[model samples]
Target: MLKLNKIFIFTGCLLVILSIELLLAQKQTKTYRNYHFVYDTADSVYVKKLAAKIKKQLHQIEFFFNYKPKSIITIIITRSDAEYTSYRGKIMPEWSQALALTREKIILLKIENADDIIRSPEILLHELVHIFFDDRITTHKIPVWLHEGIAQYLSGYELTVNDRIHLANALTSNNIISLTAMDSLFTFGQVKARLAYIEALTAIQFIVKNHGVAALQMLINN
Candidate 1:
């Protein structure tokens, strides 16, 4: 009877240890000033580098906007596409690489490969810009085109050769979409969505060239 009791105690202790290890292995997090990076243990090196880049970007963004977020921003690095989709459930588009939940102050990134490591800085900065806009404009009155445009512009998004070809084709075909029509761009099909993004970026460039960055910032503030 005593031997059986000892066996039960040993099993219970083993389960407790396994539970603690499982919790420890689930996710790892590091805090850098206002940003908190959460990623898997396997991504420690990549995430460290990514976090440093993001911190620099955050400084630049804050300096440009002259605004800083009130709370610590949580950046979650998803291990797989499936993990990313799971966060947004059925509504998440398959083409989405990153998402900024501004209200929650959380950014979710789908980091699947070494190439993703190269692209991480740009994507992270893009989402951080979104968060900056959200923090400053709480009324949620900003138009979608302006929101995406400002984010893209400040994040240094450039028109690739393919993007230019797409835009040229769109213009020649008289299929150029107006900025207003892009309010629901994400819900559109992939081809249309890509064109809408290009249109938005061009519109922002025009605004900055003509009206100036101050004017654009004023528009955001007001």
Candidate 2:
């Protein structure tokens, strides 16, 4: 029975790999300016509609950073949750909707439904910020709070009133997490993670409010 179970597991894994390969083979490519989008053939119409918006957002980001990436940015938009999880032979966190592979100049987005498709531009802008910021500085490792904070800020993630309430409540209750602990917050439960994001955004907001935009660029430089 143990041997049979092992066989079953192996076969399942093999099938998953084959399925992903088939999906990749069936992917359609669409190029818009510096961006190259790779998505399932069925998503072609959606991707085509999204490309112009993505281009506009990319230009805004480039202007904000005053830097343009020389290499093409490859974006892979996965059509379903299963394909999204199975691609690259690695499973991402369930809460993660998108990711930026900084060095590889690639962004992977999971589009599970119409809402996700509508939100794709915002998601893409966030990941693009990550890539662009990483491209600016090569030597030092950016702190998680600062990294996430900057990305959120540049991508125009506004803090809701509830977010402010949650943050204030945490602060008053002495449940506030340290900046050092922010790195591990992503692996924690959703409630904590949400708080962490709020904290990070607030931190960046404070910095920008007091120090000015030049301070952010200086921080990126050194």
Candidate 3:
């Protein structure tokens, strides 16, 4: 009888523990956040103004892709100088912030300010461009330039003054890179590190402006 009682106690304890584990698992699943998409209260007015501009810029790009105008976007807007410096790299405004993650999802950090030229609509569209062709970026043996360039082009952000200055220097000095070379140097500090960002943006601009958005979409579909 004592032995039987011990077995019952042990079984009860096991069941209780299992129940707790199940509850925790359910909570985690419920709380699994995807991306942070919200605006800063301080930048509300600026955000609205830029949003309109961005919408105008993206009109053509969206038409080309057949994307609904109301597509959802996820991004994190940073307000603090420390936050901006940390995320954007300890260098210059030419960077503003960076993009990290796969297509179908994107993480935009604080390099571009709410009051800056990034334009709200443009940022979202830029990230979508990354997501749109994310799969091709995976299989097409496409390089980083294609990834960044496409995003920059479709999004229609005029290069910031700082960015253009850097670009000018790089181009005049014959320091520009081709698609193949950009692939190798993208994540690495190939030629002044951030130079890859400019090259990618310029190249994408060239493709879309000359060949049309269909050329880019075909590459992704292929």
Top candidate, metric lDDT: 2
The alpha-carbon root-mean-square deviation between model 2 and the true structure, to one decimal in Å, is 6.4
Whole-model alpha-carbon lDDT for candidate 2:
0.80
User: What TM-score, computed on C-alpha atoms, does each candidate reach?
Assistant: 0.84, 0.83, 0.58
Tens digits of lDDT, candidate 2, 1-222? 979966765665555456555666678898887788998778888999888666766777788789998899888888777767775343334677886767668777889888998888878888999999888878888888888888888877789899999999999999998888997754767788889989998998999999986787787778
**Among all windows of ten consecutive residues in candidate 3, which has the lowest summed lDDT?**
24-33
lDDT of 3 by residue, 67-86 (tens): 54233344544555565443
What's the lDDT for all of these models?
0.79, 0.80, 0.56
- Candidate 3, superposed: residue stretches over 4 Å from native: 1-37, 68-72, 84-96, 103-106, 111-124, 135-141, 159-174, 184-186, 189-191, 208-210
* Tens digits of per-residue lDDT for model 1, 58-85: 6768888898777998888887887776
Clashes of 2: 0
Q: Flag the better candidate by TM-score, 1 or 3.
A: 1
